[model samples]
Target: MTQRFLRVAIALVCLTATTAWNDASSAVAETTLGIGDKAPALDIEHYIHEDNGFGKVEKFEDGKVYIVEFWATWCGPCIQSMPHLVELQNKYRGEGVQIVSISDEDLETVQELMEQEYPGKEETFAEVTNAYTLTVDPDGSTTEDYMRAAGRNGIPASFLVGKTGLIEWIGHPMELDEPLADVLADRWDREAYKEQMKRQEQFQIAMQKVNQLAGSGKFEDALKVVKKVLEDMEGADDPRSNLIREQLTAFQYNLRLDSGDRSEEVMTFFRDQLAEAKKDARELTQFSYNMMASMQQGTDLGPLAGETIAALKDAVGTADEEVMPIMYVLIAQMNASMSNFDEAIANQKKAVETSTGRTKERMEQMLEQFEKMAAEEADGDQDAEGDKAAEKVDAAK
Candidate 1:
């Protein structure tokens, strides 16, 4: 994910897990449309901006690449991705690649939004987006053909149409760079991508089965299935297989952590992850966050507490400024979970200091909360005839 996207996602959740494989795979599961299918026709009701010399596309002509994208006036991520899309269009326009971004909103709504001043800039959205084909399909036929037919329920989704007029790929527009480059350079593999989709479908099935087993209080059965799936998938080298493995690995550790009698097993899995992820700040923070997220009664990460906090601190030094607040807060929660209230307060203070706007406001409230809990703990200690009490507390639930 881009730093801009990470910043935005962090606004919604303190610790955003890497884009869930399930969400991406859902986009791949098709109804009447999918990758490798013929490109749907352009059903333009009003082409709002074609002034950059890229005229409105009336049809998917052979020998030309097209990016048929769906977006909206109210979608913030869609708006955030526009500049990058504009850059891509400008970069590839000479190569017969045209980007057509369509929205289902009325022309009035589209015009009102585009004419307004863009945030942090003096230009309007129309000016910022004028270099590409921006339009409104007021009748919803285009959206139904491309989006609904593919079982897609999200916007800012791009469909890459290859030179042969076949739909080459579909995904979030931000992730379009690599696939777009491949298609433009003739390095794209439709067959391998289909296999990737097939593997993802298989993994999805396994996940559903494991979840069912786990839900039925049969964690032992779930672990057995997890073991079998990993063993079966061990040698697959496709990108989707690798990603599924990563997700399954996460699921396995979380499963063990959630199983009440598996503390030693959970800690051992974490040790291996920590050793492998030590140099990667994002990986380490995700490891720590996932571990914290799995903690429940009888879930003991106490053995790895010192090392986990140390890894998170190291990550803070290397992480992006926008990513630091969440890492610090994760550290605070870990410490708070271990009843190390003083450390929790210290890290939360850092979280607040490094944050701004809504994140800062939220962290400040958390800081005050930590301080209050610490004071209450101290008072309880004093009330107990000056004897130290090892009262356990946890912030993650």
Candidate 2:
């Protein structure tokens, strides 16, 4: 990774301790599901049908080593990994390894892709489905359940369930062969497996609460829930918590902005959020600039000007090319709001100089507008002086 990326990683590591958002540690503890965790109960519906080469198609049964893989047809990685999964199915066929690929997509969407791949060969499709279960999750229940156990950042995430009806491993299908071999050999760590299952179960409960709060638009409440969940994780840092923390911070910022109250209470609340968000480099540098710009436009500088400028200067020093220009624009706007005209002009000039495309154009327009507003104020002042002079002459006469 680049130096900038290294810095960001360090920042996230440090911030993880301070953040009280989603805690995968607690989820892990509660579910006790990990590398060696027993796979939780998973009864994925078999939605597709396929006929056999010699005769009729077959259906699937539960309580087997079902390799329930979460994938999407549209996902490139998922597509790339499908063939490997097919190979695994051929290799592990009747030995009790059930490979199931399920999508949250509709039947029509999945059927279209399958038809394109197999043409008029419904028999082949049915055989494939029975051998390697391909199904859809309509209400997202199965997806939710699995996500709680193993939070997938993207598609092509697979879970290896043992014949004892426990999740053996959760990772990419490409990595499944080694774990599969181990499970087949009966050379697995049973203790670690049980602990991982516990963690997965905990994560499931935490995620359920998180989803419900998010669905209800109770973002603040969701944040609270996430904090409690993370606390339960007992300081264990996981990618899921990090992702949720990033999202929750942005959601909080948006909620504060959209409230439209503008009272001291509101301003103080937003200012505190901006202060707390510094640890999360992603949210601090990315969304905070947007918040700062909005504050400048709204003229709500109860206490954010100095705080924003300081934070932005730090961001400008550390931010990559992608975020640097925005930092410049936000600092310039904050300077302008503070009436530090020279500093404002310098920062705005830098914003225009370093930026390109639509951003540069926008900065340039802001400079022009600031100049016009200043000139108009100057003209008004001169007219007022002329009136004062006329009043003095009248008094002397």
Q: For residues 1-397, could you state the per-residue lDDT of candidate 2 as single tens digits?
A: 1223223322222221112222332333232345545555545444664442211113323534668788764553465466677788888776766676778888777776665432123443334445566777766667776755454444567777776766677766776787788887788665654555455556556666765665566656766775675566665454444554454455454545443445766677767777776765556654455555455334355556677678777767666444465566556555655555567667767767765443455667666655554565568779999999999999999
Q: What global local distance difference test value does model 1 have? A: 0.75
Deviation from native of the Cα of residue 153 in model 2, angstroms: 2.8
Q: What's the distance in Å from true for residue 59, model 2?
A: 12
C-alpha lDDT of candidate 2 relative to the true structure: 0.58
Instruction: State the lDDT of candidate 1 residue by residue for 103-170, as single tens digits.
Output: 99899989988877654567898899988889899999999999888767666788999989998888
Worst lDDT 10-window in candidate 1: 1-10
Q: Which residue segments of model 2 deviate by more than 4 Å?
A: 1-40, 43-46, 52-64, 118-131, 192-397
TM-score of each: 0.66, 0.38
- Per TM-score, the best of the predicted structures is 1
In angstroms, give how far residue 221 of model 2 lies from its true place: 30
lDDT of each: 0.75, 0.58
